[model samples]
Target: MLRPGPVEQTATATAVSVGHLHQVFRDAYGCGPARAFELIRLARAALALQRNHLSLAEVAAEFGFSSPYHLSRRFAATYRTPPGAFRRTQPAADAMWPVRQAGLLPLAHLLP
Candidate 1:
């Protein structure tokens, strides 16, 4: 038996019927499935950047990004700042949750 990953299954299902699947994802998430997935990935990446000492390359690899540059570009586009800047601005020992910057939340439409 072969099992497909989330991405594989999404791709396969979309290939079969893109309009229906796209609408379904949009209705559920207020965005297309691919965009929703991207938001989720970037959110996790931001969390990892704050909590881990991993290099951008390592984080990209761990998150299945093709390369550090790809990750940086996407991260910058989503967060409105590069990952290095986000990481550099972290407090010495943050007891509170990381503050969210603009352009980072795709589901903000669901919020107010």
Candidate 2:
């Protein structure tokens, strides 16, 4: 997970103390800023994997990984499968009818 370096400018721009900002982030995200950033990046990667025809290397580069190997290592650690294998096992669109239909439900009901 990438840790943002030196967010002093961000703190100043927001006019919030860094410690207070971190506390708010922790309260809202249930994790520190770095982990939240990692989850956001992984979500982007997941979306790309599901919707794009890009290769794993391309996906890694697209999502700001240092290299394909780095992305593979971290993705596997996080998801318990290599990205290639995960992509290969995704259900076809037609098979996702129930889940797609669930979009009609209220967003609050969809969340755990």
Candidate 3:
């Protein structure tokens, strides 16, 4: 069988639709690609909120969301709080994640 490249990976995220490729994503992350997308997006959002300089809209844009309002809606739905408020008031431990500086050592590791 031929191996798929990056675009195909995003296009067909479910194993039901893409065969073994979906399995690959699931195997690596222990979740379906769809779920993996949400998981990673939320994780990255948490890290971004820690900066406090960027608004939820900006964070959404930085993360490739379609729009600020869209980001606020989804982010709030998944996280159960508005992005702006969350940025203002998340617990330190939850806010801290492995951040990569110079592309080494994720900041998440620094958390207690």
Candidate 4:
């Protein structure tokens, strides 16, 4: 519903020219680049939780979050749980791929 300001757009567009930024920008959606990147970092944090044991501050720095408190606040808003608690309740791996087989299968061969 909100648009990115000039500065945020420039930064995000710059990231788009890079590699993984494409996926991050595409997957992370919010009112602006900063918001989207925050969302991207959140998703990455969620992914990171799959293997790593780190505090909110650690995750925040790794993902460019402004601060641990900032990460905690937004993460609660997004996930409805604290990071540590959320990690404890994680579901099984097979549950992650999606119910649709389409999403589970790699489609790179059909892309070109």
Candidate 5:
């Protein structure tokens, strides 16, 4: 049997329609589920950039990004710095703190 995706599972668990779930997610997060999920993924990518010796392409692939360029675009948009620069400058241990300060940690509970 096919298992429901996260949004469908969330809707079922919360006893709400998928549309309602989307609306609720937007109201709470100021973005739809997809955008929120993207942000969460980017936040994790940020940590990986800081903490790992992986190349940008590797980091991008590991985080489900299409490519290093795509990762750079999203990372720059969200964190105001390219992933390469971030990786070079950020301390590994402090990676997630900046993300937390930027309000990305609210959805961290949804992370695997």
Candidate 6:
């Protein structure tokens, strides 16, 4: 048997149905749990790019992405730039501060 994924586990832990969990996430974060998780993952990947010298494949593997190409696709879709370009241009100190300081709710903030 397969173990429950994070959203399902969260619903169980919180004593709510998965549907209710999704609803609550949507109400609080303007997106469902899956999307929130994705955003959090992407944000972390971006930070890794800024603060490390890991190759794209290493970064992708560390962050649970299937491959460097997959990471690039998602990163480009979200940030409008590829991971290599982001690493080259972004200052480590400013990796995510601007977005957070601008009042965008970081998905990780919703976690314990």
The candidate maximizing lDDT is: 5
Model 3 residue runs over 4 Å out of place are 1-17, 27-30, 91-93, 96-112
| Model 1 misplaced regions, further than 4 Å | 1-8, 11-16, 90-112
Write candidate 5's Cα lDDT for 1-112 as tens digits: 1112478887898899989989987777677676677777787788777666989888888878888899899888877878888877766545555446546576666567
Those runs of model 2 whose alpha carbons end farther than 4 Å from true positions after fitting are 1-6, 92-112
TM-scores across all candidates?
0.66, 0.67, 0.59, 0.54, 0.75, 0.79
Candidate 1 residues 1-112, lDDT tens each? 1111365476675585666777876676567666665565666667788888999988887766778898899888866679888888843423111223323244433422
Clash count list over all predictions: 0, 0, 8, 0, 0, 0
With a 3 Å backbone cut-off (N, CA, C), the pairs that clash in candidate 1 are: none
Clashing pairs in 5: none
Q: Report the lDDT of model 2 for residue 69.
A: 92
Q: Give the winner by lDDT: 1 or 3.
A: 1
For each candidate in turn, give its C-alpha RMSD to the true structure in angstroms.
7.2, 7.6, 8.6, 9.0, 4.2, 4.2
> Candidate 2: global Cα-lDDT?
0.61
Residue 60 C-alpha lDDT in model 1: 84
Number of clashes found in candidate 1: 0
How close to the true structure is residue 30 of candidate 4, measured as C-alpha lDDT?
A: 16
TM-score of 1: 0.66
lDDT of all predictions, in order shown? 0.63, 0.61, 0.57, 0.53, 0.73, 0.72
Top-down TM-score ranking: 6, 5, 2, 1, 3, 4
* Worst 10 contiguous positions by lDDT, candidate 1: 93-102
Residue-level lDDT of model 4, residues 1-112, one tens digit each, is 1122355455576654333544544454313334443444565566666567877778877766678887778777776777776677873332122212223123212211
Best by TM-score: 6
